[model samples]
Target: MSARPTTEAERLRRCRQVFELAVRDRVSMAVARDRLARERWAEADARLSAKNNTALCGTAAPAFAETDEDGDARLQWWQR
Candidate 1:
């Protein structure tokens, strides 16, 4: 049988996965921010509001938060 992954290898794999996901998320956020800057409020809001249910995959993280210029709390997709 093939050798199993070592603990260090598994940790590295998880870290890599997190980094890749963070990169993808940053790219997407940048695009949304650009569109928002262009006055595409609805689209930007929708994108930012989109919820990521990583819990389904068994990973739990803190929820995202956003506030409008008026200091009003924004609703996330999960909140909708």
Candidate 2:
């Protein structure tokens, strides 16, 4: 298989190509898409709900963790 597209432009171009092919084939697999989305959401929800630890503002989002030690860890790269 070919390597995955690395750039945003290349990824969008690939998506357009896939969309065109799907349209030409009249392949509207909405059920599969819905199922996949549901499964993904369930998995994400499970991860977030596990151990009753759902506070994502501090654990998942780093931008809001500017004063956190973990957030300041990126400063090492900037300093280097």
Candidate 3:
């Protein structure tokens, strides 16, 4: 049987569980630090991905407007 991919939340939960286990078992400081680092990295990566997606799918604008007051207000290249 094939296995499904893990989601961000699941991975985070697993990382926390591992951290707790490490503390209980007196694992190396490096191991604990690594787990914490991985958790932080995952969070940062998720945030970056969300921001990029938002940028790509920007706010909607009028597509078939007869005239755009805002656009007209802006100075044209020739005017500049």
Which candidate number has the best lDDT? 3
1-80 per-residue lDDT for model 3 (tens digits): 22898889988886777778688869875787677679879997888787435554576444685866658447674477
Clash count list over all predictions: 0, 0, 0
Expressed as tens digits, the lDDT of each residue in 1-75 for candidate 1 is 327756888668755655665576665645544543465467666666667645445676767888465533444
How far in Å is the alpha carbon of 40 misplaced in model 1?
34
Model 1 residue 49 CA deviation in Å: 28
Please list all clashing residue pairs in model 3, or write none if there are none. none
Between prediction 1 and prediction 2, which has the larger lDDT? 2
- For each candidate, the alpha-carbon lDDT, in order, equals 0.59, 0.64, 0.73
Leading candidate by TM-score: 3
Prediction 1 global C-alpha lDDT: 0.59
- Two-way TM-score contest, 2 vs 3, winner: 3
Per-model TM-score, in order, reads 0.26, 0.33, 0.36
lDDT of 2 by residue, 43-62 (tens): 98889787757475556433
Better of 1 and 3 by TM-score: 3
The stretch of ten residues in a row with the least summed lDDT in candidate 2 is 58-67
